[model samples]
Target chain A: MSDAATQPDSYPVTDRSRVKRLHERGRYDHAAVHAILDAAMVAHIAYVIDGQPFCTPTAFWREGTHLYWHGSAASRMLRAQKPGLPVCLTVTHLDSLVLARCGFNHSVDYRSAMCFGTAHIIEDLEAKARALDAMIDRFYPGRNAELRPSTAQEIKATMVVGMEIEEASAKIRSKGVGDEEEDYALPIYAARIPVTQVIGAPEPCPRLVDGVAFPEGLKGFTAGRRLDEVMVESHRTTFGVE
Target chain B: MSDAATQPDSYPVTDRSRVKRLHERGRYDHAAVHAILDAAMVAHIAYVIDGQPFCTPTAFWREGTHLYWHGSAASRMLRAQKPGLPVCLTVTHLDSLVLARCGFNHSVDYRSAMCFGTAHIIEDLEAKARALDAMIDRFYPGRNAELRPSTAQEIKATMVVGMEIEEASAKIRSKGVGDEEEDYALPIYAARIPVTQVIGAPEPCPRLVDGVAFPEGLKGFTAGRRLDEVMVESHRTTFGVE
Candidate 1:
């Protein structure tokens, strides 16, 4: 079976608790997990088809203990996820390139997290509606109540998948270049080139009508000050984020 | 069979022609994809494991024809990709989100790409060395040659997997908030809001040795003039920004 027919599942995350090297196997701790997840705006999900694997990425919202992922009802992933297949959900935020001393040693400084869990389909109309509202609320508040509810046909055409926290770990490397002790004295220059996400001046859509000022929600995207707040709030609901 | 038993030939990429969407999925035509992947520096890859699905994100590099991903020798993806497991790779970059006129109508504008391919393990010592070298060179031109070659023990312990693109597509959604046509003239402001990635002044590593000026490779990470180059380079690679 494939596509909407439902293919067999084939990917599993390594057991993090069994590993001794914390950096290699453990989640950085709660703060780090939240920080990394909050900093990210998207996620990549992977699954197998015919003994092969495929990864797909989409917008997501995290509220409390659950992560919500939604896409077209006809999406290959959506079809496969209907039974709540075991899925590996991962998120990464690249801080910068860690230019190390040696060829094999060259690495990047990044914040990434991986989790293993089974995603079950949310078939309830009320839950689906709430999930959609959560997504809307995260991207812009007041819109869920401000706008019309999803039509019955539209809801039926969309697919939403939900995954619990389950087993997960967040690992990070933020230091500068790492070279062997001997290479330290060499002519090499090693430093952490810091990188960050900064908001830019807003470019309103051309289709926006004249004389209408920016909404209070518009203040959210300014330099990402409110981004974390929004994301944290989004995670508060089962729908994840708007 | 597992990594210990499977040979490279066991994991052939099924149906290279299935990736026919490659041309239509070019990263440039889709502003959503361009913005998302450009803003995102990391991605997740998925594969099969004991009849389960798994996904993880590592640092990645994209040239014109290929997307390069590498990690430690013990990486599970490396072991799985050695046999050329059919894989779907995805990259997503998120810009300012759209808080549309309706709750269920809210959406995020993003840039994303997915490719189906078989990974051919670069097992030859020389080839493995070069692939690792090329990954390093992709970010820093002269640095790879500056480092020491991996010891035999290191090489043996390390696993390297390379995926050759067979088929791919880049999907995108950008501009502004998508709202119901009837609500367009209402008090609501519906339109696309732009988000940007800005490179700040390079903070040289504190350990950077004295007497050695910043390398030319670091030019792109520099403040001011170099920033534009970074964006242009990314655009060119993702969608031929020129």
Candidate 2:
């Protein structure tokens, strides 16, 4: 029921003005949303069970303004509430290491997004499977066709939660620290230590059917970190969400 | 009032088995705590406000097992909490990107810690400044001596919260995806995209007070993408926590 006109009533602060640095901020633009969501593979999810707070790390993928992250069948967050519960999901990517003349000035170059919304425990088998499929294809296209299908036990042991990306803002600082226009004269070291995601030479499994060589599926697969969790979760059972 | 023997009760969960891999887990010992506490500069701090979930990114430092992370004067978590309101603090470091043969096998190499406990607000100026210094000087040893000091007004405008890292377990996974013995022949690209954090050449500020170079205290300055916080914080207030 929410769209572009979304307000902050659903957030900790509705007056977006409180969010310091308004101009440099990336607002509700779709490009900004998709860019941060697509590049991020994991979301640090926070929610409460009873009066106690719980933060569960999970694998997630974004579709439009919604996020899908799932975990155990018996997870407290997945089972704490009846149909739904409030949750906060955040994703951050470290772009560079900013080494400064002073340790206090030491900082980082990063892109991050904080999204808040109520999560509905996705229960439908087909919807859950498709959600699971989107996660797999998020990093490896046509992956569903190439892998073994999940058995009933696996699905039963998994819990997939879907959240609408309503009330959200992305804050990012990419270049270097603010060395002030006139302060460059000090003899201090300052530079953005660029951190690039480069693919390393592949390490095949030791137990493969003897020198079978990698299949076409893994050809030049550089984006493996994005796929690892999806593979792990898809393999684990829906132990709590059921 | 707390010791390692019974500190486990302070966290949400005590059973070591619930956390999947508890022993080989990177934070299995005291040094692991120091290593993680030292390596990380910022933590994705999560706290509940007004019976809802909210997370604000903040700069944090660790002393022994207790964790310290704080925000601005108007932060919701600090002001919103009733006395002894339960809070969850979590800090994570994305170590590397793991690439596997299959798309679903992609994963991230990381070390993370989650602690559940009650948050107490610091209302005293003398104590708050010392706490802030503990948080700051941990990163920059001698800079607090060089900066201006904070006034009573600045101190009142900041909201600082402290938590004893009583009951907590750190989870870390640094390896690649575990493919089935027979799956390796199927052309899955399995390997790690090793992440390296290195300090780049330093850039001196140009506006130095004539001939004053980067201070001798600036050597061996180790900071990372994990630390974009406190930098902004130290700049905002004269409350130097060296």
Candidate 3:
């Protein structure tokens, strides 16, 4: 049921994707990279047009070694990227705020993945439609099947893009404050405040059709659940991975 | 005590920063752009190095029309950006998941600010030190002053960069699902699930000195409080702005 054993265990680290400064925190294993990517809902994609860099944040999902995202067919960013644009997609989960004894030591604990690849629009209609449904099911498993089928015009108005991960690295720092040994003795407070994205109560549309019940398959989105955890779980459930 | 009246009311909309797709959701006013930037902690800064774009997620703070972030002095990203690199800094808050009756209409409500500017390293020692402290105090208010002062070595090892906003725009979507008029009658579950980042209990460092109490000024970081709301409130309290 799983193709995990056949895949490469680690990404080939290139000069651009290598973690230079704090190399100890860098992980090139597919597990680390995939986990970070799967747990994140939004990724900031960086691409250059006319030597000017632009970072656009958009909802993205991962399937195997590929990442997918969509935008309006007419979006400037999407249009520019349709011709196989060199892009860097980055996902970061800010886990905690590390307040140290001094300003210099202040840092944030986060898990971040950066992937370098060329993104191209999915030109095939059948592939694009499947990718679109996969994205919806990625978050709300099984809900896509129950939703109203997409219209032909709707498919044409959306531009789905895919990027095969070329070189990727995950940088994670999850420990407590790392102040100097001397600074730890200073008469100052030091701690890590965990940061989390959580789901709140769902607000049903005021115009919901009668007898339409809340989608039970969206159990992963239950109120008060940590958003990242739920997303990782949903991805596992949908992909049939551990 | 506010300088609100003296500042420019809106950023000059540039060809690149203009929201071309959904023009109605675009905002150029200082209030809208600044509010979205202030409410978020992490900003993905994009810069091109040898024609390869990189999106780096970093903790950032906004003061007036300028933004600041810091990293290790020897970092590659910082080194490349020291020469006044053209960059885009984007901050996004995913507010809700809008599950509509069809895949085409499903979306995420978000408030995002994208700022185009040239980022340069802060060379002046005094200004860099002040900016570092300000970045710390931006989130924790008065906590920076109470913490142990930064050492000369610590200051030298850090690279602080600042960017004055050149062209900026805020794209916001806060409404519920916007499915087609006829699709609203479909027998499908549709709703907006609110998404929020919240703070958990602070975990004190195991090596903390005795009698050092949790900073009371961090009332904004109280457990269960929304992280974005607390950040905005902290910015207001620190900068004396509404």
Q: How close is every model to the real structure, measured as TM-score?
A: 0.80, 0.74, 0.96
Worst 10 residues of 2 chain A by lDDT: A233-242
- Candidate 1 wrongly placed segments (more than 4 Å): A1-25, A28-32, A209-211, A223-242, B1-41, B62-67, B145-157, B224-242
Ranking by TM-score: 3, 1, 2
Candidates' DockQ values? 0.44, 0.27, 0.82
- Per-residue C-alpha lDDT of model 1 across residues A208-228, encoded as one tens digit per residue: 668877766555556434344
Ranking by lDDT: 3, 1, 2
Query: What ranking of all candidate models by DockQ puts the best one first?
Result: 3, 1, 2
State which candidate has the highest lDDT.
3
| RMSD values, in order shown | 8.3, 7.3, 3.9
**For residues B1-242, what per-residue lDDT tens digits would candidate 1 score against the true structure?**
22312332222223422222323333322243333444445667777767777677766655544566766666666776776676676776665666666555666665676766676676788876666666565555555555555677766665666666555556666646666677676665665554544455666556666886777655566643322246445444334452
**How closely does chain A match the true chain A in each prediction, as TM-score?**
0.80, 0.78, 0.95
Q: Which lDDT tens digits does candidate 2 get at residues B39-80?
A: 656566666766677765666766555667666666556676
lDDT of 3 by residue, A102-170 (tens): 888788899999999999999899998999999999988898889888888889999999999988889
DockQ, Cα level, model 3: 0.82
Across A35-95, the per-residue lDDT of candidate 2 in tens digits comes to 6666656677877766567675666877766888877676666776437888888776666
> Model 1 captures what fraction of native contacts?
0.66
> Distance from true position, residue A205, model 3, in Å?
1.0
